[model samples]
Target chain A: MSAPIIGLVDYGAGNAASVRRLISKLGYRSRLVNKHEDFEFVTVLFVPGVGAFPSAMEALTKMNLVKPILDFANSGKPVVGVCLGMQLLADSSEEMGLTKGLGLIPGEVKALSSMEWHIGWNTLDCVGECSIASKSDGQNFYYNHSYEFQAPKEYIVGVVEAENPIVSIVRKHNIFGMQFHPEISQISGFKLMRRLLEEFTDA
Target chain B: MLKKRLTGAVTIRNGMVVQSFGYNRYLPIGKPKVVIENLDRWGIDEIFIQVIDRSAKSLEPDIELIDEIATSGILTPIMYAGGIQNEAQAAQVIRAGAERVCIDTLLHINPDEVEKIAKRLGGQAIVGSLPVGIDNNGIIYWYNYQTKEKRLLNDRLLSLVKDGLISEILLIDWQNEGFDEAFDFRILELFEKYNLPLILFGGLTSEKTLKKAFDAPMVVAAAIGNRLNYSEHAVQTLKNQLTSAPIRTAYYHDRSIFKHYD
Candidate 1:
């Protein structure tokens, strides 16, 4: 019954401090993991990212974190990706001309076809009983992204209708992806993170 | 359906929150953290904080204030404006917990720098802020805050939009910035052709006026500042009244579920 030690992956493309701050606010301990060795002692891994796909992939490769993240996701422990971090979980991205991702999940990231980017608060339309969606069912979360995950329909757990239905949340066993920034999504966002730590991690 | 946004804007001056009137007269409204906390609790779609005095004096963004707001654990996505001259400053603001940065003075003076910032941060993170005013002859011009100068809104600036320098446009009506008047509909006409997401701000006080702005096809968000400070749960009240509009309902109506973290 010990508190989980969360490893916040800092690949230089995200606001790791903000995610760490949110973890602290939720009454948990988290450390910024910049190297593969930093993931050794943590029970859960949270990859937080913003900005472009190729740059994020480059940062992870530069820090030698690509193997470690894939290893962690395969270990049957919980690994959560947020925003561009979520997009990075895919096989490849068309953000800046077909950049290869970590390939943890069976999917690819592509540009949203809509003329307007989905930026602001949108309601989470939960389609399954995933722990993150169960806590955040029908609640609004903040989103600011121009690309979305195109995964197989079975892995898709949650979606938001903006111009068209884009994957907002996805889960395949221990690997989870949230296209929205739960840290900045207000109370509902915090609740979803709390559920992920308290329920999903334990399960 | 894509919901229209109801944003609560906090204008900061001299490190204290102020009630800005046409960017001239100001009334202090306590600490910004308190205002931001209330806005989050009220379930506002987003929070826009613009530090008015920083750009004129050439000071850095109020990192201390931004840190305070971020640490305060306000959950709404934050957009910070003012004193953002280059990519580093924009990145700093984002690291300080702002989801987006609005560039007003920099957009006109050094557009190339804006392009650099856009490249560093994604185009979605950059917002083109044009404080505009119309003349008697019905021409749109950029209204400069410090120099009181007016520059025509021409193709050079419009080219920035085409070049993907900024993803969103924050159109400010300089003439009616601090008063309770109707939004300048003419300004909407000028930028409608671009088809960019527009956030309209200026003199939007009443629910009727807000509805009118939201009714516009191009306006994605309506930002209100002074009016929200005077009342409790102003955002919730406004959303409650404008139920038929595209604005999202306030989720805080059931306050039992939300935890007030100290």
Candidate 2:
């Protein structure tokens, strides 16, 4: 009956504090860890980000969190990457260059060339089969990034069909990723996060 | 693919939501907690809360309210702006649970302060909340509400960019305050060359205005307020009407499943 420990990996980008606060609001205990050692008792691993892909990966590497994150993803312990953290989950990004990612999913993070940084409250165009996100029913979630995930339809659970469509939700086993930041997206974000937390505990 | 951005703005006067016409005419809305909770309900992207009265004279961050929002399970990133004139204040606010700090009047008073804060919290964490107004002559100017004075907007914007002060700029058109005339793209014409991430606020009455605003590359976002509160199905109406995909979608993956972030 101990409180679930949500491991929030802070790789020096913004967005961690908000994620931490959101989890706290959900009546759960969360900690921001830059090392894998902190994952000992962690039930869920949340990676929050707010910058470029290469820089995020670089920070994770510098902090030596890359392997721990990769291992967590492989462990099926329910890991989620938000915003740039989501981008970092892909295999590579064409942003600054063809930089490598965590490769959790078979995809690439490409720049939003046709459009500017689509920064706004847009609907989560739910598409594929997802336990939590698929029920969104055109719910508008918050977003703030300029890169798009190229995850194939099989891996994508939803699409945030805004000015430009992008993979809004991706899942592989227990690993989950969100291109839009639910932590900062308000009640919709909070509700979704809570649902994921419930799923984590239920599973 | 096209991307879009969502910005939910909450005006604070003494730590509570206040309504102001354009950039002036303050009207008490309610507690910041309630408004934030409501915004959270709507699934807003990012929340921008600006303090109308805080300045160099006032250093308090309505810490109690901010603390409340930080812990209230409102997971959205709250961008706090007010009385931030130094790096200490900026750092304090962020550490107190603000994801970003929007700067204005003071940032111009001591441009270095913006640089100092941005350096500590990364340029992305610092945003220029410029309150702009245009005269009959069509000259854009930055309005100083405290002194009731006006200065050329281009110069201020140039100075901020040249000095590496802010990574993004939130433009609030004083002239467009409550009229809902749609965002004036002409105001954005001058900054097209600069190409910094710009968010347009004020006069966003209809989704039609938003569609037009989204056409510009530099105009990354447009925030809606009163109209949302007045509408019945505001969330769905706007979502259905705002056909253009925002910039945030491009990089976001699973925007569906709710997350837990304590």
Q: Which DockQ-derived CAPRI band holds candidate 1?
A: medium
Q: Model 2 misses residue A10 by how many Å? A: 3.6
Residues B58-113, candidate 1: write the lDDT tens digits.
99888888888888777778899989988898999998888899998887688889
Task: Name the candidate that leads on lDDT.
Answer: 1
List of chain B TM-scores, one per candidate: 0.95, 0.86
Per-residue alpha-carbon lDDT of candidate 2 for residues B71-171, written as tens digits (9 for 90 to 100): 66666667888888787777767766777788887656777677777666655567888777667898777887777789875565566655555767888
Per-residue lDDT over A110-133 for candidate 1, one digit per residue giving the tens place of the 0 to 100 score = 989764478777788987788568
TM-scores, each model vs. reference: 0.96, 0.73
DockQ of each: 0.63, 0.25
lDDT of each: 0.84, 0.73
| Number of the predicted model whose DockQ against the real structure is largest | 1
